[model samples]
Target chain A: MRAGDEEISVSSTSGSRPTSKDAVINLDHGDPTMYESFWKRMGHRGDITIAGWQGISYFSDVTNLCWFLEPEFDHEIRRLHRLVGNAVADGHFVVVGTGSTQLFQAALYALSPPDTPHPLSVVSAAPYYSSYPAVTDYLRSGLYRWAGDASAFKGNIYIELVCSPNNPDGSIREAVLKSENGTIIHDLAYYWPQYTPITHAEDHDIMLFTVSKTTGHAGSRLGWALVKDKEVAKRMIKFVELNSIGVSKDSQFRAAKILKAISDGYELPNPKNKYKLFDFGHLLMSVRWKRLREAVKVSGIFSLPEFQSSYCTFTGKRTETYPAFAWLKCEKEGVEDCENFLRSHKILSRNGKHFGAARKFVRISMLERDETFELFIERLSSLT
Target chain B: MRAGDEEISVSSTSGSRPTSKDAVINLDHGDPTMYESFWKRMGHRGDITIAGWQGISYFSDVTNLCWFLEPEFDHEIRRLHRLVGNAVADGHFVVVGTGSTQLFQAALYALSPPDTPHPLSVVSAAPYYSSYPAVTDYLRSGLYRWAGDASAFKGNIYIELVCSPNNPDGSIREAVLKSENGTIIHDLAYYWPQYTPITHAEDHDIMLFTVSKTTGHAGSRLGWALVKDKEVAKRMIKFVELNSIGVSKDSQFRAAKILKAISDGYELPNPKNKYKLFDFGHLLMSVRWKRLREAVKVSGIFSLPEFQSSYCTFTGKRTETYPAFAWLKCEKEGVEDCENFLRSHKILSRNGKHFGAARKFVRISMLERDETFELFIERLSSLT
Candidate 1:
């Protein structure tokens, strides 16, 4: 058990106050629940149906679900094949995964040598996905050094994880030369319809997607990576089967179900909308961008840049696509910690420093509903 | 990209046969969707709101639902703490997973030393989880050695994954003392109210629980391990966060919602079910046990000595409590390869060999709803 709670005190300048007494206007973390009133407006509530005794036999049920899913989604497979075929038009094979994060770890596992010493050179562009440095440090026992800038990224580096439409800064597709010296794994977590049209399908050796973002059900835990090389995909899939106990067969079915829902909508259209099927099957591109623009205007503490200036669009034109995240260069004065300032006030924004950026950039999620947006704006305004 | 498609032709066994033409009874796999009629009854048609967007975004209105998830449940830190606490009580702390399989690989990562010239040795009791060997082999690059018996388990051994209520044979808890040489991680996926009392609060150092079993909502992609050691839990949690880009925040909320549902039913009293709650709960348990017994009696392909010799005890019965899984020791005369035989017959039972067991055992799930159980019995009878 816990060896007698040794009172360990942690002090953070942004949030070191006694949490119990301190009323936190939390902007530091990305919990969607911060927008409670809005969730109630949508169909979500607090009522959960217990599988009851039915839950007792879920193990067997799960095994069976996997069996049913493999065949029923043959159309899905074909659809994925068609999607991959589009990727193959660029040349890639879609590697299905529990989440693209699994693929990220797998890529590291597959590429990194076991004997690699501490300070293995790992590099990424400034303001990339925050998790890149976090994951690398985590895997290497907090010993993995974050190699300098992408421009200066050289030497016998072990691996590099880069995210487009980057986590905190919302940087989209940038250029990269072949990293023959180090293995390069592109984490295109937001490369779906939200950030951009699914272009450059065959550009990278690895690309990842999940049901969470594409379907707006991040809880589904279904994500996959498209690997140009079959060997990598095979390794990644095998890695997944070993992790999280094969991504809950039930999860895959749900993903397939959700995907089926998307496809079904496409095949059987809603006449009221004047379309034969739901043109936007399971994706959330246009709506999110609108919300992002709205949030930026309301929350004055954030510094907004022109399109693509924040790694969003390649050009400044308002397009039909962009991811759900708006990376804001938070004005932290000389503190140089944008993520910290927001967290102190109870807003959970991601710190850009984790993504190799020197400045304090924070990633604000546009996933909240209207009331939440208002609350976030109010809270943000007060903070500034 | 996939190499020249023209050059890759499959043998007949591996070739894509027409679904209708290629059926040996598929008992080897565990899928409950085979009985879709029940799911429709359960109101699992599809999410009406999710039908709108075709992409997932941070600001997607998906979380704003009135279906019964509370806003408080979305706190990731608190929820993740609970998830970690649950895992620790089960005896292992390594969250090295996006899935349990990911943990399996993480165990290897933790256990396997880089300088060892020979492949690391992995050992488990017979009739283990099937994915063990498959995942282990996949990670070893065809070099890891599987020391078959518990007695021979020895040095240079990186890790050992053990499962209680041994998958195919239903051996409740292995005598772990005999196999304590290596870092022992237990896959207690089935250790729930079925085999273990909900009151069996005696926590272990590590264990695993997936929503698939606890709530029958496998699609949630939520699972956790209970690791007691703080250090290990920290590492595993880090591994998980890095691998899957942090578990689907949405899935975590849904799972917590379901968990509260399960806990609520047992903890509170409702007017609709005075004694009805207790009675209904027990009845559900009986239903599962009855189904397992009936399937065995009618099919006669497998023997379930545990069920035949089980008692209705509340606690400390030294018996497995997970009612959903029926680990069977296969005794059929010609069926040496349990996996192949079950697959050929269209009954998808997991082969026991992967679980470090003799090939005579297979893990069969008891999660089929009542009607499907009846149908499965008929299919089994036909096999006889």
Candidate 2:
């Protein structure tokens, strides 16, 4: 609830302390490049070779509703979900997408009634993912329109996008508006054990997961949506079909291999199984959070939200959340625009106004390279 | 143009095909699996491997507007276009997409004026590509709406989609709606040497090309648009960024390799280079069309459009167009619906009405595997 005022001594990492004063530090977007070192340590276990003739066909499995989805990709997705115990993939239809972003749009399209006299209202709580409003309105879709602030919304029939371990601000969330006619889409991109506790196996009407956040393969551009309803799943597939014919099988093939490697690190009966993706991610996130907290304490100008500890079934431990981003609030006198203040110091951060929050709040990515994070900490510590 | 009723004698191929009678021939979609054999012959030339830590970041080149586009892929694209003398890629911004389908939607978004009081009307000449209206209106976008048949459209301020070597019907076409205020997106997906004669280098304001049609990698789900206008290209890139963040780097990496292999077949100074993709495609298409014509002549029930020969700049030879899809019209009495007529005999074809054409005509994909095409020809030969 407040900035950590007490300084705690800790052993320094092998990486050199940041001293660069001229390098531009951009913590605007959650790029997730921090996981690159772990992956490099994992090495060729995740490497995949795709021949010219293999996966050349348009259809992967013609019998499935999502015919474009690679069978191996689907298998690995379900396997990963089962391994983590974060989401229930059993008896649910899996629809693969270009990314969670595309699947989000498809969810909105599927949930909205086509025969409605007006565009279906789409709402999320205040400080929602920055993209929710921008993406919803960018296309100017008549099928659905963004109705900001779900708790303030009065409509009964609306689509709610609940980003649990939410973006900009990391908080486990559910639909604030209570209505039977309302549809909810759970964006569980950050619900993995690394960022938050696997409190329960989520069995929502619709859930979206992305490799970008889970395995830090942002360039792979692969995501999947698990839908409980057959019709809604089919409609989402239809949207993808009409959008890109289907996803790239090359990504699917590579992603399947990458995910298989991750799952194998835990599931396989091996002596040295230390390359577990979640374990690596969790350790990195914890360290980053600790470093950020120390930097904030030294700066004496910013405050961070305190998260409650929860028991994680996957990790078999009670731990506080380690979000991919830091929602920092500028507490300095007359520092109303925290993002602008940071920009003046050669630090780029996303203004909280984009997420429908106060000008004093700014979202700083904690998923950048180690050197960049060190630079950010050094810059922050120098601010006061 | 009318169907050629004359008996065309063709030398029989070595393969003992046309024996499968119970097989269900689904030519409803252009799967483009026929190019598999060509790639197989090329073998290992198009293979690509990605390391666990490579391409982990979301950005490929932050300096470019299309930041997600791999510089290697862009270079290969320009190299291929120059080698083939198809589209003018120089001095143009290259925007990679999920497929040409995604780029088409992006074009629609870019071309449509967002502030217009009414949705910008989108029209293509009939019978246009079947998905034009479906994709344009599926989202019910307020930015643009599908206005059927470009030739019949009354509005001067509209967007025109001109598919050269047009889908369903293989006619080299230009925009029918010629207005100073009108925007045209030329879908040159089938304008390659194998599908059609490339008479001149295309220099359209917006041109879309896909590997699915050009290189027979439909599963790759990769395409690029060459845009003359900088602002228009930027808007299209924005649409893609919002739709999927960007195209998959896996696909881009593999597609670049595949395209490079194709170009290398001709460019590499080797005497025994026999794995030319276009040559293979052209030969197969010629044989398929010959067999199809012969089968139709024997069936005496279906008609096909007659095409004129043109000098190809790339091939340096005069040849009639070999379209990826056959526009087959039922000549039999009482057969008002050709798609339905074909469906009864276990042969699948897309209904012509979907393309704003007569129900008597259907579009049969010419890009399916050899076995399927052989079965289709046999089925057609036995239909009457």
Candidate 3:
């Protein structure tokens, strides 16, 4: 595969020829494959075998508002919370979803009252996750409307979305607009110790998390929200029930088994247990970020944000940002559209404009496999 | 368990008491547990074991609009359609979803133009799936509104939903109101040979199918749509992309494996192959429906819809109606609400009012486990 790249001819017009050899390096989606080796090391322990008759019934448990959640999933989620010490799961009700995307929509549906004379404004800080506006406004719901940039918003009743360890830039964020009439939904998808320093447990009224960024199980399409209010949780559950009936139990069961393995690995007594998911993830991400920074330094055509070191409660030490994405700003001449510039070099990246940011910047996924990252670095270094 | 049921005293006002000894029989949800014994017969052939590194990448295929769909899923769907000879798949673009629920919403979203002067009215016949209105109006989306009873609906432009082998009842249905402006979405969720006879291949613009009702894997939460138009298919794909970023690949993979098993069982040379999913499902459902009819006959207070026999292509014989749900009408004096009457007797059912039908009728599920169905029959017979 490495030699095939050199043999294939590159087309300047189309960026890259659709040959078997020089396929375009896709860094557009944040698919976490850095934990591949870690998961592979666990072997059958991390594997999931679902029987034909398993989860034959649609209802998981009638008593719980999130009746779609498997009991093992509920247990694993609580265990992971206790181990990470990131979220307060005791009082909060957990609502499962297809992914954090569904939960994000569900949160909007739950937060906004249907009888509101005007649709409740949903706002987030600039350079937000690209899907926020798209998901919120696509349906054109009368209950809520996307009001971009919370900093400039002056709504009486609004829903504030806070994506901590923000998607594009990877900066730890909070609600910019403070108001008594506002309800906040914290998207803690990238709040794990591997991505950034965990300052303290987030006890927000509503918090969102996904197995996609956490355990690199994006294909599983599993996510959950921790909601403080029972009514809100019930509403979210109703939204899911009406949306997809419920989250897939097969995925939930798989997630539970994988999460259990991760929790067990984290609790291993030996410091050098090697099976510890967090330690493995942290080390891999730290190394990848270091290599990426070094490569970018050599290129001198691009610049990355300088993230400050912070104390992490989980690691009991200071650590720098190890984000899943590299927010790259092209400093070269005639590179106004950084995404197009990267595309010309056989690389695909998400445009910063999509995230309500400047066209000079682009978001590249650092969660790809090591081989893809290496090729990306090689292609990027040539731009110097 | 039988002895415990006999020992517990039933409450008239609140229905069944929440005690460890007496558990309520949930006949409300159409969870297909009738295929449990059939699946058990297949043993490991029906089991799905996913490795840790399997489906690690978020993107399944780049060319497809729904990039998260596993290729095996596409293949299995085509195979199943060909085997059943129900829906056209050759020229149609297949869009995978979380379930038919998401697909239904997607169809609505895709059919309605966002810039239209008013929301497009979405309608279905009376006794439609109970979730239609709830799912449509829950978000209060201005793109579309739920207009009940397609027969009485008058609209210039609208999307009509047609659930063949209609839910809450066993009657084979067709669109009552025909208009060129009206786009039809055929939900073939219960059109399998086990539930109803497949008269001919349904060549609708948009046809929906789910693994939940077809294979009794309700918890997997996987569904697909056969869309004839490329633009509409793309729009539906966009809905799913914005909804959950695509369906779960883990569930899709499992669905593919199970679907392959079913197809393989069907294609076996020997007609006596007990592992054939359709045959097994048919036999189980036929016997169950017969027993249920006998029990209802004994209980003269209840009456069931008399369905005409139809020639089944799959079975190569005429078959009576063996529906996933038994739409029962209470004819006893003082029984105004059939669901309430059944609830008072310790049987939980879905009220016909929920399906936009009269309160005198209640929908009882025929998809429960053998033990539960037997208990339901015994209790129903005692009510006579």
Candidate 4:
């Protein structure tokens, strides 16, 4: 807390040191910049316009941008609705958000009934979206307890957040969420083709997606949810209103624009041409996965199970699932030791202990291009 | 929720047509852009090396920038930090956020303690920030209640979300927040010179600010808070970690870069000669306010009292302060009638009834520029 100190103290209580968790490769988080082409394709800076719902775009107002942007933005929004709606069905409502993270929070708020009980028991799978427990626990504090297993929770309400092609161990099967009843919420953050090709069941409970992963523009922060039940969507919107007020109109507009690109086949890279394919998010994810697997093999500190067993079904059989990350489980005796070794070398990776997994595993985000990945592989090899 | 509908039905229930308030302005939310800038700011695109703090400063990479971008982009972050930090004190930790709106949520989450008899009771002046009740109700539901008066109930924890120059009503007084055995979460969202002078009372409380109001870059979605108490600060960090997975690193870096523009005085309309002493943010805010006030006078639909009396210390023997909003107690027949009058002309203003105001008034934001205000005034005049 000293003012003159060079490094700001990141901890409240005196601890050994802030963990090198932040420095780790961060494959733990599903940021899509790992693929070079996906990164290059999305890294353009300019205000994009969309068609308006009424007639003219709301942002077309050159000076203040209220009059023109709506009409232009609407065209993009309608296109996105068609694309995302086709992915699911048209009967449901699509509520855009800052990210699926906001939607996830909103789902919890919406599902929770009026003054029910102290510490409401919220249950999720043993291995779930790593943030679910954290976000739930953080908000619910004493108001809710993160009851691990859904079946055991004999509480008033059972809320489960399921992430497909899940984080850390990328094992997402529909059967995994079978036990979720009462109120089940799914965080389909990585369900995009970049991670896995198998989309949600058209009439599944509730699903969420973000343009950041699908388009490799994490900065846009636009995500939406397809909710089968109208009441649930309403409550979620209310929660959003309470949380941050609402998602940014500009970000929403941009997301709608990007969605148009994907539907037009202009955003995604073609898998037929490796280089050209890399320009597409799904294709880029594939390239990063290959590089990551190579790095993991070279590192020798961990062993990845067969892709099939991992249940990471990206583009079809034999086609790797989820390019932006390679969730490598460390079979070593001490994952904490491996984590330390990597951090000391400045190659940051997310520790697996947080995701309800054995400490001996690490989630490495494949964010580096070939050169950086090769350098990382070389450094990783030295660890063994 | 038609597949190709430009405007989706925002509400699930069959109700009146949606207005700005009904639809959710989300001005209350933050982290506006998720991470779309990651690729665009950096020249090479995907996974570019951010020189400091991992892809932070704009100059580290700015080839894909807009025409308005400055040439000296490299020192953007440090400059922003200086600008934001200087706005407050040198010792305070101004961690840039997705937006000040996110910080508000974080502040609430941080203050809500575990093991409470009832949910945490939040108290603010009547006609306080509109988000206070909505945010508390959304998360804690029955656990937390908005105490209009300080004597309503006795709770172990009391968080005062002080939105000075307040939101909706634009009211601020030193006595408004009496930190007697309670935590004061001061939302200094509009305490800049344009709204009011910096009211610094070192009694010990948490304060928040966002670049959105100050810089008119709501799309950037960046804000930060300064907390005197370390425990409170740590909890806020945890809340952020769980919620949005930490503000986008790219946004933070961009924010840091913009911070420099504020500090180096380069952000002003004329940094060198004419507008040397003017802070760009203050100038912009003032310009907008001037136009808004003029429009209000010309139309006479509502009156905008002096900004200081609404939220902060008022001048000339009256000490009142409110954020950049005019909380007008409608002299008209019904609140709904006034709302309809404004809405008929496509003008949007928040109703103060939601903020617990005594009278039927509307809270109009002065964030719009002069020209937009003029058009809105013309429309309002026509309606009248």
lDDT of 4 by residue, A91-198 (tens): 655666666787777777667665655655677665544555656665444345567655445544566666666665676645333434466666666655445545
DockQ of structure 2: 0.46
Q: How far is candidate 2 from the true structure (C-alpha RMSD, Å)?
A: 6.5
Say which candidate scores most in TM-score: 2
Top lDDT model = 2
lDDT tens per residue, model 2, B1-384: 011101110112111123457756778778788887887887788888888888878888766778889999999999999989999999899999999999999999999886777999999999999888878888878889988898888979999999999997999998887789999999999999998888999999999999999899988899999999999998898789889989999999999999999999999875875778888888899999999999999999998998999999998899778999999999999999998899799887788888889989999889888888988888899988
For residues A186-206, write the lDDT of model 3, one tens digit per residue. 999999988898888999999
Please say which candidate is ahead in DockQ: 3 or 4.
Answer: 3
| lDDT ranking of the models | 2, 3, 4, 1
Candidate 4 per-residue lDDT over residues B202-231, each given as its tens digit = 333677877566544454456667766667
TM-score on alpha carbons, each prediction = 0.61, 0.95, 0.93, 0.69
Candidate 1, B-chain TM: 0.67
All candidates: TM-score of chain A:
0.69, 0.94, 0.93, 0.74
Could you list the chain B TM-scores for each candidate? 0.67, 0.94, 0.93, 0.68
Docking quality category of candidate 2 according to DockQ thresholds: acceptable
Docking quality (DockQ) for each candidate: 0.16, 0.46, 0.47, 0.15
Q: How displaced is residue B35 in candidate 1, in Å?
A: 8.8
Winner of 1 and 3 under lDDT: 3
Question: Could you give the candidate ranking by TM-score, starting with the highest?
Answer: 2, 3, 4, 1
Candidate 1: tens digits of C-alpha lDDT, residues A1-384: 011111111113111122342334333333333223322322222222323222222132222212212433334644643442223313455455556666666666556554444545666766666555544543333224456466666565556666775655555545453545667777665554445544444367776655555545554446666567766655554455445534544344445555554444335654553221113321333554554566656765567544531222222333444545666786545658876676667666666655555446766766554445556555655554
